[model samples]
Target: MTRSRATLALATTAASAAFLAPALPASAAVTKGLQDQEMTVNQPGLTPAFLTAAQEANVGLVRFNTRWDGQASAPDPAQVAAIKAFATKAAAAGIGSIEVSPNISGDASFNPRGKGRGPKATDKISQDAYRAYIRALATALKDVPVARFYSAINEPNWFRHIPQRGGAILYRRLHNIAYEEIKAVDPAAKVLFGELLPYARPTSKSYPHGQSADPGAFVREALGLTKSWKGRGRTASYAVKADGVSLHTYDFQADPSRKSSKRGRDAWVHANLDWAKADLRKAARTKRLPSAAAKRIYLTEFAYKTSGSDKLSTSKASSYLKKAWTVAKKQKVRSFLWYQLRDPTSTDELWQSGLQTRDGGVRSTWTTFKGLR
Candidate 1:
């Protein structure tokens, strides 16, 4: 994941404190959530301990990630059971599930560099295979009452990620595939759209290795929301569909109130999610997808880096968090999730944005995050 290098450019100096976006009153329906993939899945005593933690924190939802091939193959039955068990327990504990499929559409991998099969992300996913797997997974999980919202993939806007080149068009197709399948299994189920990274590069052009697509371009093309969208893809029938718009943000260097002056409408950032929502609504209107327009924006993943001089000061991180909630509230975001409850084990880890440090210390942002409406 050239993601480390991909985001290095967006690291801007923190914004002025006095220049905050006018904060709106928090929405009463907003459901705060947390995403600690490692802890929620592998934490010891997951039932009494982890489940209790989520219950205590008022977590309305928790995200669970899996690969398409893992469940489809059924080679290791426990892997599938673990997912069902987690959702069942979370439901019992009063937390709903947000399932994310990260990779591998079939029961095999293709190493683009070599013929031998491996986990090197060299080839794209096959939509047909992915659709079949998602349908099965959704049908299997239909028994788990809490397993409802499904996010197709994480960070489709990241550099060199799977389902690339096709950009939003590619991602939209994948999302629609999952959307139709999951909906078939549970009509009440929702397929989240655009688990896109929150950065945008310069306008369309041939790119060097490791550059990200202009997310705005991806979003528009994916939904056929462009200026003249009626004739795209040589068809009047819809190409891709989504129930809700999903975005992931970890724009560490800037404050949430810091809007992209030139790129706001074209891409997603903590500040520009409102623009994305408008796009989703416009697309839904043009496409006549009623269910898609009814969803509130879902900020599925977000965090601020703390502890290092290069990162935010604990106090600043906390301030930024309060501002993030302000942005969310103003945008009427349905869910605002911090990336992880605890930071990775060491500073070397790429995602240093966690509510609690690995050494069992909590940052000021912990209280600020834990208290978000």
Candidate 2:
């Protein structure tokens, strides 16, 4: 899940002295010959300091969000320019790939009036608009080799992000449009299904925010394992166009070793993947979607919050990071991205999941991450 800009205020507190420990040497243990595996940070910009730090740590991917708002049927020109600039700088810094998420925000001026934030159940954006925006984005970045991976949306399963009554169906439509638009511009480009917020069960009906759907349930609906929603059953198959799935797997606990007491479910780091894979396999068999079972699983966002109820001491966070990587490798995850590179310094613990303090001082997990393959 991407942090709202309001949640990323600079830290006012001083970095803890313990974070002053020296970074591991470059010759430190490196995973030899791992293929198609990437360690990335989901920072918004490609700042020089961040790029330098990422290079030193041998991290080769940077994922960031770009907006498709402020225009009726195209991305904002300024946002397009910024993406191009980001790609150029990332390549210069030796980053291998850049993942772009074309997120739709709640800004009224950018979206059709009355159809953005807190959208009514009947609100819907035309497919033509979605296709045009996606096509423009893909065309703008087509020549940039690092801009090979694109996500259709970000956390659409979350009600606030795409809050129509039949959000799952709406998101599937958007994803299909985006996949075609992107592939039309560059067939080699890989368009990922939008990342989903991991929730063991579907959001409760009485929940205050829009009706957030469970990630598993949304995937099932998309892949045709479940019947179409109230007004969304027209499409014969929603799975045919999707290339792969992306997930944001942040468990409630900071310690990955703690097993989920839920019977028949895998523990800790395996929680989301175990259930997701099972759902996909069942859908694939029922719907005959050939690649559904083997589709690449990208754990696009995974990290322990360093503060709040989920807070972990620096040492514990480091240990969790290492263990999480071990589990992801064993599970054959395609890409694992730490949610952020720097923590927000505010007293709010939810925003403090970075590997470094807000002031850019290295946290213990920075050392552990550098040593990961």
Candidate 3:
């Protein structure tokens, strides 16, 4: 999910109104029309423009990543300052919530070859360091008025991020640690399990790097691990401790509107959500993991590349975006965040999925997104 470099860029409440609103039924609590974007807030020139567009689209939520490796031992003063600035700016812009996922680059000492894709594989921060970093981050951002949501890591199922012998186990441990540490500092904040990249099949032929864990099998295994912890007298299963599950639905090599029947490793776009939800339900059936079934699904990253060989025409992209929202609504997803606000570069095929051109001009799909209810 790496992209070309570009330039950079909450609010709180009415906190009482949100906290005091009679709690809606679980189904009702699921945010049906809220839309968000996954943007690199640290990019210069980018954040301001993205914020303007978000306000125009009536988007209230924004998701971004903060690298734990960058702040593992001690808080990075610059990064912390940037975060604060971004939060302040966002709140003034009428944004309501900011979801930040800490990117955990694996421990190099444990795996010399490194785990994860590209630079992520070279991240050497230890588990304890990761815990310390998130705690520090949560404490630093606690005073910010905007609702804060924290996802422990980004895409654990991606091989380059967790390439060790027991990647899934390692991920579960990391997520639990983050959840505990974040809550200890900001109890009101919501902690989400790291988002999973939806793969149509359980495994891929792109060996080594791409033979990542199947999202379905990975969740089941992760939940089973959490369930076992309960039997060992842990206070609560990790499966149920986290607020929600995050997933990316980027229908690679297939049309977003097409349904996929294949299971375990299919990359079909439309079927990924259904398969993921079903997998969660199935995992929860194991008596030890019953609560897993109740978590809300957050589609945190989704987009269609517009310049790649598999690129969809701008008109087609609009149609797909519409359908994506329709499916998300039907699935009762808590949030539907598109991959990005602006393309990183006009030439990078992989990063051209943004609703706007590289220079921040609107694309055909921008109207489609703005029209989303």
lDDT of each: 0.59, 0.58, 0.60
Which tens-of-lDDT digit does each residue in 67-141 have in candidate 1? 444224321233345556566556545575555545333221221223222342324555666667777767666
Q: Return whichever of 1 and 2 wins on lDDT.
A: 1
Q: How many collisions per candidate?
A: 1, 0, 21
Off by over 4 Å in 1: 1-28, 45-49, 68-77, 91-93, 103-123, 201-210, 225-238, 262-264, 288-291, 307-310, 346-348
Best TM-score goes to which candidate?
3
- 2 against 3, candidate with superior TM-score: 3
What are the clashing pairs of model 2?
none
Q: How close is candidate 1 to the true structure, as a TM-score?
A: 0.77
Q: Looking at model 2, which ten-residue stretch has the lowest summed lDDT?
A: 11-20
Cα error, residue 115 of model 3, in Å, equals 15
- Cα RMSD of predicted structure 2: 8.4
Which 10-residue window of candidate 3 scores lowest in summed lDDT? 11-20
Q: Write the residue-wise lDDT of candidate 3 on 299-373 in tens digits.
A: 777787767665788888888888888888877877778776676553633456778877778888898988788
Name the regions of candidate 2 deviating beyond 4 angstroms: 2-46, 69-71, 107-124, 200-211, 227-235, 262-270, 288-293, 345-350
